[model samples]
Target: KLSPPLPLPPLPPKPIPKPRPLPPPSFLSAVHQGNNDWWRYLMAVGLIGSVFFVLTAALSTLALGLGWISLAPDGSVTIRDPLVSYLLSHLPFGFLGLGLWWAVVGLHHRPCRTLIRACGSLRWGRMAQGAAIWLALIISPLAVALLLNPGSLMPQVDWNQWLRLLGLAMVLTPMQIAVEELFFRGYLLQASGLLTQKPWILCLVNGILFMIVHLDNPETGYGLGWLALYYAGFGIFTTWITLRDQGLELALGMHAANNGFVILLVSYGDAVVETPALFSATSFDAAGVVLAFAVRALGFCALFFGIPGLRRDSVPPLQPQGSASEKPPGS
Candidate 1:
């Protein structure tokens, strides 16, 4: 009773609540809306698996009809037709992967500008930066190898065929890379992220799925342990980048450029997806393959992520997954 409570200071004015900006739509956010469990994984697998099977078969047949493939009377199928084989391996994933995501996630029910990024759109500059960095890393190693072992690489140009392959590669290679990025790095990563918030766990899960799915490739089919490491590294690095960047722009650019260069400049000996490259290597260079891992990891992490402006300060904040505003009203 200090002087009758000292006459309380004038009450502070109430803070006007700031208007909240709407949340950006993203697949990583959307996956949490519905129940995600092993069953959903299996169902997505089955649905996408069926689409892959059917679409590949239909396209393969069309390829055969177009004389891009050969079916022997003995029931042997030939993958020697580079253009057709590449297409058969990948084309279906483009359209069908989108369909699978659309149906499984029910995008129509809850609209997201993109399942690719939380920004509601891709930042093209990031993609370009990623592509440029990876392209340099990939080609530099190969170029050094080519210089050292000139005899190891040979030009195999059937102008007509090379031109044809170039046309098709320009069209399909990006599609193929996009397919892998969408499903593995984008879809699978987002799906798995819902199960756990730890970035490393999500990376591991997505990496393992990627490595397993690619088991059918010639590199894995023949049990090339080193190549397995390469793919594993690829999955992990890309997934990690996506998590850090909070988007697929960088990852997609890296994958596309990596595959694009591999298809055009030189190809490994035991390649499953052969293309009419300008120069084909006689054997797989273990040194080059090993160097690729170091370059991609170090270069991507240090340079791309380290640059002043390139740092991920631009990404928007995300709302809590189970927040009242996150889910639509009703049961």
Candidate 2:
């Protein structure tokens, strides 16, 4: 009776469930969140990036002129000495350029990681996931295609030179790919994004720049425009994922894995890179190769972009640490 009577007194209402906290905003979101004048971003990211790259190019040219590093008249680095070749491939992406990007980001009181990833730091986990996906999706497919067309592969290698090349690829290729990513996806994306939040615009601009940079690459038979298209497409695919995921970890991982594999397993023609990969593409059906590449890339994008809660799209405490008004004075 007492319990029944007590039940008459309604139980206290249950508390409302609090929503899970959202992580901090990524640079894509940050740029949008900030009330920045489009130009401020351009200067912070684009201007700085351009200056650094130009400076580096001049330095690289100086190195070539001085014979510190050998280069073809067309301005491509010649791989005569294993060590010099490694340096040439890696120099552009090295501290000279990337460090300047980092420094510029810091100049505006933003962490370099913000330019590089939404997490404001390098997320190794995301990178690994991306690398794994690239290997499974793209690298594996390329291997299968090569197997199906064995004649496309280049002449057999001397294990000694091949082994040395393998080491070079493992060590230097990552640096080269990383440099490219930082320039294209990191500073370039961030700076350009300030102009417009539209993903397609960003994709085209970044993609074209990427393709242009490879103009001197000797990869032939695919036709220059077609090759450039492929490069642009690759850039678009990567930028798409980077923007969607709100970080560069996946892009870096994917590129590193893709280029690493290509450099170690196969390369051919006036391909910008001349690695001692196990095989070379002596005969590539450009259309088939490009189509196959696109298919694999699409698959990669779906997996990397489709996952939920794999990681925060941005770091936490989402208040606008990036407000343009908040941009450091004269930054």
Candidate 3:
């Protein structure tokens, strides 16, 4: 009996289940994926940087040859023909690089249709927005004059230089504006939006970076406080329009016209580059510049926010929400 009882003691073992695999990435998820292809982004930056350098070198060479821009014995690059120098220096690479990048990115990645649809595609609404922005530019300088110092509004320029500057401004303004819009509102804004899934954050970040780039302007003399505030404010206004309208048409139009007027109409003695028209005043008095900024701000607000037709139908689409591990490509 004891032997039989001892034989009855057999035990069973427990079984273990296998671990599950991680989910694939979604479109939005992939955008935030810590730049899995860091090399590509770096390459893009390098390519763009190289284009700028090459353009600068080419312009310098041309200037030296033409006697437009000269390196003096004292090491200053003086421009005998500023208008020609400006045109040669800026036009080739200013907007072209950005245009090329957009074309390449759009073709290669095939972004969502929602991203590419211009304000005009939304119908007549975009045109109104564009008009409003243009009006703001027209009114800005004048308003600044009225509010601050009317005398400062007048530009002083030699008649010949003014004509030359005006012509150059006409040629260069579009390119300058296009470069800004494509890079800030288009590329940087869109990319940031997709990554953060927050439209406001994207806009603000773009604006901040945009402002930072202007810090080195010889005109500003590296005055961090004034320049920073001025650019930040400018960026905020522009970003608001880009976000509110869901396209860059208004921003582009406004920027083009803004710089056009500045180059053609507003002139200052110490301006980094000479244009045809010069402001009567040699420098921006604090009150005068503030007034100018205010006018520009108000104009932007009125054109984009005041007008009924210009309002966008939808906020630009943000990156779809989800964990990176669970998302798919190009979502």
Candidate 4:
């Protein structure tokens, strides 16, 4: 061997691999498992509308004939028993739920659970956490309001009526909330995602649609603009959370709690879903209501995102379930 072998040249530096891009959030990407033709969505919409209209008209006629509901000269509706009215108002949602299932599962051939969560199941624990957070945010302000103006607390129902209302609310309120969550945040939001990947864009469009849906609500009397903004804001908030969590459980829980509180604890004049609430406000405070909403929205986001273990989507990348009729694109 040669006395002096040249030292081996220094090895070249290894190339750093570029990080793989992350997949879209499961709540949006869930749509990939199904056929996404525009006409299919239109069919789903038509089905939902037809189902809702038929159910509402039939129920209204029956309620009027039964003397359970009355119409005033100005077209204001009065329900004889708030509990029965709640049932009437919420019953359509049960049918609508079926229509939605048919739309997502039957028409689109997508797994139904994908409409609710990426994991193909409902996370009851996540829902309960969301409910607790919403309750705390709402109750805090109500407590403060009562302390400031005790006179505003006018009792609206006896304990017996409240007990009955509670029972009905425990059943009907969640049903109503689930349908809404499934439609707007689940179906509509995913549809919108097909066109854009921007979170803000998705949230903005969802908000506008939600506002339009609520345009006919009795709360519009507070000021059409204010109510519109309020409804839109709620949509944005819920949609944002849905995107963040990659599921509808949090939204469902929060919505259920909000409606339950209004229906069972406190209500005001011109409420859409009349209930035998424990207390009624003599005057509507539109500004205060909006402010409280803003506060709650901020608190909810901060707490949910900042706290460990509060996020549901932190586990793993979304995996399409075998139940999907079509294999997801690029899988």
Best by lDDT: 4
Residue-by-residue lDDT tens digits, candidate 4, 201-236: 888899999888788887678777766777888899
Candidate with maximal TM-score: 4
Worst 10 residues of 4 by lDDT: 322-331
- C-alpha-based local distance difference test score of model 1: 0.67
Residue-level lDDT tens digits of model 3 in 249-281: 667666665566556666455454556555544
- Residue 311 lDDT in model 2? 36
Question: lDDT of model 1 at residue 135?
Answer: 78
Q: Against the true structure, what is each candidate's TM-score? A: 0.79, 0.74, 0.70, 0.84
Q: What is the number of backbone collisions in each predicted candidate, taken in the order shown?
A: 0, 7, 16, 0
lDDT of 3 at 245: 55
lDDT of 1 by residue, 53-73 (tens): 877778877888888778899
Worst 10 residues of 1 by lDDT: 322-331
State the weakest 10-residue window (summed lDDT) of model 3. Answer: 322-331
Error of 4 at 184 (Å): 0.4
Evaluate all candidate structures by whole-model CA lDDT and list the values in order: 0.67, 0.63, 0.56, 0.78
RMSD for each of the candidates: 9.2, 8.5, 15.2, 9.0
Which residue window of length 10 is worst by lDDT in model 2? 322-331
* Candidate with the larger lDDT of 3 and 4: 4
Ranking by lDDT: 4, 1, 2, 3
